[model samples]
Target: MSFLELKNIHKSYHLGSQTFPVLKGINLAFDLGDFVSILGESGGGKSTLMNIIGGLDRNFDGSVTIKGKALNHKNEKALDTYRRETIGYIYQSYNLISHLTVLDNVLVSLDMTTLSKKARVLRAKELLARVGLAGQIKKYPNQLSGGQKQRVAIARALASDPKVIIADEPTGALDSENTKEVLRLLNEIASEGRLVITVTHSEAVANAGTRIVRLADGKIESDKRIRQAYDRQDKEHLSSRPLRRLASIKTAFKHFRHNLGTNSLIIFGTAIGLFSVILFSGLGNGVSHYISSQITKVANPQVMSVSRYVKDSDDDNALSMSTDDTPALSTNQLDQLKKQKHVAKVEPTYSIPSATVSYQNQTVKMRYASNWTAASTADAIKIGHAPKKAGEVVIDQDAIAKKLDKEHYQDLIGKQIQLAYQTNKPSGETVTVSLTATISGIGHSDSKGAQVNAVNTETLQKAMQQAGLSTDPTEASVKVDTLDHVEEVASSIDKVKDGHNRLYKTSTIQSLIKQLQTYVNIATFVLSMVAAISLIVSALMIIVTMFMSVSKRTKEIGILRALGESKRDIRWLFIAESLITGVLSATVATVIAYLAQRGINGVLRNLADYTFVQITFRNVITAFFLAIMISLLAALLPARRAAKLNPIDALSAE
Candidate 1:
């Protein structure tokens, strides 16, 4: 039995409804160590016969038997395996990958073998040295001479130790001296106990082999042998497997570096979109922090102001409404609030929409005045102390500076001031109430143009009683035991109700800060979304770039497929390249965001005494993964198109 055999092979090509015959019923046989040449004219179907024998043209009627086992041509995986493990091809055009060096060109085949990486490198070097191109290993194909390029192709054909080597017009592009050198190499390959087949139209090239088969008009005309086959030997061959994902990624990176200028621009474009998102997120965080700090300076976090829940009331002055319109908390409600968990104390308070203070026969209108409670912090008073006694009050520093004394504002802390305000009685009549109290402290508000004055609850209530008006608690300040319990206690107070209507509404410094932060977040999200429109453009750019890559690398795809790389392997090659692009873009965006954060914060700190941008680790990581996901999604259509290409047609592409 022969080492390899072909029986009754037939093939044709279809142009619309017409069929053109390429290979007519041809039978051939081969043995190990035989150098056979298929000699023919240009259109004699010699290459078609070679393709059938090498397992590349499977759409035919033939039984390709090797060592008594016929190939299952219908099974693509089996055909790929046969090509990987049993056959090797050398093209006359020297179809070397342009981006790879000579050494890497040969290792492309060796990457599928079951050898360690170090061992693969050593073997590649050995093969290059054997071909007399060891010193040229670092040079690319375009940098090598024709003879040197042919030598590289020869080394690559033998990299996997395939049993049968197929060369298609190997010397057609070489000079006489290079042709002679290449024939010597083919003869030497035959002597290694392997089957060597060459397709050539040159009679001189055909005679260099041991046997010759003449082909004409898609049929074999004659078969002649001048010498016998070489002696056979038993040896272990190099094992082959499917291409690994890491190998595909390495190749992709090489291609990426080859096209760095264009890819760098893409990375920069993508980075701008991601930078805006990260910057906006950091700005929101900083604004929240600043607002919380400012409010906490004037108000206690552990104390919350509680009032009656009014439905659909848009009154701007509702907090300072007259006693008749404002809902007064009953004794029962006060007892319930004091009984709540985490509640330390509940103090009733009163307020008026407007008031006036008389000092040394000069009068000035105040914005508003209320009784002091736990909700008012001592930290707000810039001088003197909080109002403690019934006859003491805290006046805003700005009011004193503008109305009474500009330079001597602190001197008015111990002076007596007459305060008067108006309220409504139960009979629907309004009257004025007056009280005299000492200015015990001067308060300050961080909010611009806000003037708040405070007096003791006892003093205000005493003045109201003397005016024949009912003085009930209009609001209460519920003091929590700890700052952390403020939110919980406030929620409980808000849930207090009379039948279907909610009884009380709770407000805290923390709640105010949260509301302000919510507004900031909405604005940040809107701006970030607008910035994200650029990301769509960036994705389109990536998609266009990958499609262009697929068009440019069509021939490279054929070479890989012929080397037995699976469709899945080809798909991941493009995906890996895009992923690298994404990661680099995200890294650039992160660096830019950090730099912008520093620059913006530097200027804002000098003007506002606060840092206004704070980028977090979560933002960086979110941007990183978002970039990767977008790139991966963008690569899918192009990669699939690449994987679906026909290996035979791809190898024939220019």
Candidate 2:
């Protein structure tokens, strides 16, 4: 058998639902050290034949046997190996990765090899020098002349020391001078006992080859001998490592290095969207976590709370009742409410909302006025014991807005503070008073009064009188005899008219969480949506980048097809590039967001006086998922467009 052989081969393509046969029963054979030239006109399928031979396109019919192994319908993986290990390709356009230096470009395909880094570098330099690029190894593709770039391509083809070098008009893009210089490199590669199969339209280059093969309508019509044959090595000297399958992550990185200026600008452009999405989501999460924690710390979950809604709240014109105009329940209404089915023990409480606290004449208006419940409710306080009598008041941790020299977060607990108050007379006259009360307790509110404490009589009376005009009022929680009956008692409390304003302990706390959640949820929605816009922008950025790559590498994509890189591979290449860009962009975005989130947390933490919730590592992981999903999704459409490109036109485009 000849060193390389092809039995009758056939190929066809589909256009708009119709099948057209292109390559009809063509046969050919060749051997090592043969500089074989094939001359053909445009549209004659010379490149297609070269692509099939190089195993880039594996859809052809019939046998193409090399060294007794048939290359028939092998899977893409196997063909990929065949192309990487057995065939080296040179194209009309050099197709050097634009961002990589000549030497580094030569090292890309060998990424998965076990060769030492130094050895790899040395090998690349040696090959580049052999191709007359010794001094140009560090120069980027654009920095070199057209001939220099083609020489680098030739050196790259030889770097892995493949058994066959397939050149499809390698000299086509060059002027006559550069074309001759590149041809001289091909002649040298062939002279070194390597098989050089070149498809060209140049008659001069064809004359220098040892044999010439002519094609008409895709079949070899003539085989002409021009030189004596010489023996050559058929076994590859390099590893059969696959380009993208094996750990070519390094290759992708190297490719990135070559394209840094272009890709960096692209990635930077995409980051705004990504950063926004993460930040909003993260901030929302932080707020949610904070509120949830605050609620849990302040209440018991198994206990249910009952609240009364304004019956016609949905009516936009519902009458607005003034806080003071809403008449307090009468003693008879209170009695009727107490007699309800689940009637539990109840307390009568009084609140003077306009009350202010005074410390040596300085006062801060209380957001929450004096709140009194049945002594039972006092047990819910976090710091002190339950209170039994009037004048002794339990304070909220932040009730005092005044700057105090206190130490702990809840330091106002045992400190002495006074309640100053005023009352509006029925005749529309306002009266203010100087009644003083000591802090008898400090606590959080919850049902059951678990944390509640008793207030001493002295403080209780002071609060009642200091608020300008409160006759002694009693406040209580209905301690229902049974757990299930508690809800009934809570509901009944809502129907009561107590001659004085009264609020059920359970309803107030529930309303607090609901109100707080509403406000927080709005923030979460706004901030997260703001962040999502960034991710959307990032996706668009990725698409733009992939589109640019497809545009710039049109010639390379065509050459890849000619060298047996399938339409699939061409598409995959674009996808791979997008994924790479995504991964890189994600990494960058992650770093930025991570630092930003932490910085926010750091500032907030120091403002611990202002911050209630603590942000943790969970934020990082949340942001990571956002980035990866956006990245992969962005590449899908661009990859499809790349796959649909016609190789003939892509290659022919300048």
Candidate 3:
């Protein structure tokens, strides 16, 4: 059996129902160590016949048998495997990837082997040395002479140790000296027991080989043998495999570095979009935190004020103050609240919308006077302290400024004050409850709202009882163990119901803090979304850049396909480039955000005594991955288009 055989091969090209025959029932047989050349005129189908024998042109009606095993032209994967394991191509144009050095061009073929990386590099160096371009391995194709570039191509073709070497007009573009040198190399390759096939139109080029098969009018005109074939030798060949993903990534990086100027502009534009999003997120977080701190200073976060639910009332005073018509919390409700989870203590208290206070001969009317409880924080008191025992009261700075001694308010702390308020009895008769209380502390208001006047609950209740009035508590202060449990405890309290209506109404500093935070979050999300619109532009830029890359590297794609790289490998090459761009852009965005955070916080700290921009670790990671996902999605269409290109058409593209 022959090493390779083609029987009754017929091929034609179609143009709108018209057929042009290229090959007609051609029959050929080749053996190992045979240097055969297919010689013909320009329109005689010499290259087409060579393409069929090299496993490149599979759309032909023929049986291509290799050592008695017929090739399956219908199965593309099998054909690709056949090409990778058996055939190597050398083009007249030298087809070396421009971005790669001579050594790397050879390594591209070796990358599809099962050899170790170290062994692959060593083998590539050996091939370059054997091709007489050892010192030129570090140079690119444009930096080398035509003869040297042809040597690189020959080294690359021999890198995988294929059984058949296909040279298509290999000496057409060289001078006589270079042509003789290339022909000698082809003879040496055939001497190693491998079949060498050359396609040419020159008689001298064809006669340099062992045999010549001349084609005329799509038919073999003559089959002549000029020299005997060399003796075949048994030798081990390098194992082959599909290209690895790491190899694609390395190639992508080389292309990325070659176009650094354009890629840098893209990275900067993408970084601006990401930086705005990150900065807004951090700003929202800092604003929420600052508001919570300021509010907590005036009130205790873990302490909430609870009152009996009132229907259809929008008045704040009506919700909190107890009246003859309004319901008050029963003993049962208070006991249930005390037994609730995370509840530290519950204290029943009273509130008076209006109260009169007199010290010596001076008198003043105070608003929002209530019994002192844990709901009030000591931080609100600018002077003295909170009311601790019976007969003690804490008056606001406003009352002192109105009627009391505003200039010497500290003098009233140790003095006694007369307090009186009007309430209803059980029979619905209005009566006045008055008592003498010591002014233990004076409160102040930082906000524009009214200040609170607090007194001991026991003192007020005792006075009400002595005045023949009901002393049932109007409100309760529920103290939670920690601030985190305040919301949970409030939720449980809200769930407690008397029939269909809620049993109690709850209010706390924590609830106000949460409402403020929700507002900040909504604003931040809206701003971030607006900033994200710029990413759409960034994605489009990447798509354009990738499409340009595909257009520019069409020939490179063909060269890779001829070297045994699959279509999937081509797709990943572009995708890897986009992903690298995304990673660099995200890194630049993170650095810019960090620096802006520092600068903005520095200025705000001097004005408000607070940091107004806080960027979390979560934000950084989220931005990084978001950038990668966008870039990956953007590269898909261009990569797919690049992968779907026809290898023959791509190779012929100018």
Candidate 4:
């Protein structure tokens, strides 16, 4: 039995219903240690026969039997395994992948095996050294001469330790000296007990082999043996070297580094996209914080203003000032509010309708006056102090400035002030009273609206009772334990159902804070979407770039296919390149965004009193992931194209 057999091989090409037969019923037998050359003229089907024997062309009608197993043309995996384990190819073009060094070109084959990284490198280096390319291993294919490139191709073929070495016009492009050198290497390879097959048109090249077969008009005309095939001695067992596998990461990195100028532009373009998203998001957060701080600065976050019910119309001053209709809060309601989560203290409040005040012959018709025990906790006071005794009062500086015909109303503090107001009792009777008290403090002018003097609730209530007015507090101020829980507590209070329609109306600076934040978020999302369009454009750029790369590396893809790489490997190689670019772009954008945030915040700090840009780590991670996903999706079409290319046609591509 022969080591390899081809039975009834037939191949042809078709052009618009015209049949052009290339090979006709060709049969051949091959054995280990045979250095056989197939010699023929142009169009004599020597190349077609070589392609069939090397497993590159499966369209032929034939049964290729190796070691008693026939090849299955339908099973791609089986064909790939056969090529990887049993056959090696040396192209006439010396198809060394241009991006790889001589050593890396050999290592490309070794990467398919299960050998360790160290073992693979050692074996690749050994193969290069054996081919007399030891010192030239670091050089690229373009840097080497024709002879040296051919030597590198030989070393790559030997790296996989295949039993069959197929050379298609291996010496076709070399000088006489280099051709002799390659021919001698082929004979040495055959002498190591492996089959060496070559296709050539030169009779002298065919004569160098142990056997010669001549093809004419698509059929073998003669087959003759010049001598017995060289047999290896016991001490010369070079074909038994173990196969070692290498990673493709190094290949991807090499490609990236080789085109740094182009790739750097891509990275920068992608980084700009990512930077915009981060910058806008950070700016939104900063603006939201600044607004929140400003709003809460005048009021207290932990202090919630509780009213019987909010007046639906700001013009309904009568409803607002009518204390008779004021809904009395029940003891049960106060207890419930105190028991609520995070509620620390609840203070009762009293109001007197239609109050009039006089100080030093300047009388003013004041709005409804209220006394909240928790008023001292608010930062609304601008001068003096909050009322601490029954007879002490805090006046609004703005209202006093108007009545006094002067600014700087702080002089009114520590002076006695007269107040008169009418209040309706539970008996439906109107009561009028007048009292005098010393002004204690002046509240800030920016306290939302025209404010009345604020006093202790107990002090005001006691005086009202003496005047025959109802003292059952009209409103209450609920103090939460922490500012963070103020909104939550307010929500729970609003949810408390009661028979009265005016159960509780909650208001705090938090409502304004949330409204501002909502606007910021909407603006940020819209801006980010606009920025993401640039990323989409960048993705399109990546697609175009990857397609261009695939076009340029078609021959390299063929070389890889010949080296036993699966289609999936080719796809992943391109995908990995995009992934690397994504990560690099993301890293650069994050750094730039962080620095931009610092610069903007620094400028804002000088202009205002707050930072205007704040970037979080979450933004960084999101930007990175978005960039990578976009890049990967963009490369899919190009990667698939590279993977599906025909190996034979790719090798023949210029």
TM-score per prediction, in order, is 0.90, 0.68, 0.85, 0.81
Worst ten in a row by lDDT for model 3: 315-324
Candidate 2 lDDT over residue span 552-628, tens digit each: 77776655543344455555566666667766776676677767877787787754423333333665455556656
The digit string of per-residue lDDT tens for model 3 on 1-654 reads 999999999999999999999999999999999999999999799888877887767799989999999998877777778878899999989899999989999999999999999999999999999989989888989999888989899999999999999999999999999999999999999999999999999899999999999999899999999999988978998889999999999999999998999999999989998888889989998899888877776667888878877767574222255666667677887898999999999988787767788888888887778888887788878888899888888888875534588677778887998888887776878889898889888887654465858888889889888889766566788999998898899888878886888877787776677777988999999999988998888888999999999999999998888887878999999999999999999999999999999999998777777888989988889889879988999899999999998777778777
Pairs of residues at least 3 apart in sequence or in different chains that clash in candidate 3: none
Clashes of each: 0, 46, 0, 2
Give me the runs in candidate 3 sitting further than 4 Å from their true place: 295-298, 313-342, 348-372, 377-474, 481-488, 499-501, 508-510
Candidate 1 local lDDT, residue 343: 100
Candidate 3 to native Cα RMSD, angstroms: 4.5
Q: What is the overall TM-score of model 2 with all chains considered together?
A: 0.68
Candidate 2 residue 636 C-alpha distance from true site, Å: 0.9
Question: By TM-score, is 1 or 2 better?
Answer: 1
- Give lDDT tens digits, candidate 4, residues 1-654: 988999999999999999999999999999999999999998899988987887778798988999878988667777777778788899889998887889888888877766667987999999888889889988999999999999998988888788889998999999999999999999999998899999999998999999999999999899999989977433432232222222565688789999999999999999999999989989998889887766565446777766566546343111123345657776777787788888889877666666888877888877756774653344666777778777888777777535754664767778888888875667878787667778887765332464646765666767777797655555667888887887798888876666656467777667767766998999999999999999998898899999999999999888877777778878888988988889999999999999999888888777676888878888899899998898899889999999999988888888
Q: Which is the winner by lDDT between candidate 2 and candidate 3?
A: 3
* lDDT ranking from best candidate downward: 1, 3, 4, 2
Off by over 4 Å in 4: 232-246, 292-302, 309-344, 348-475, 480-492, 496-502, 508-512
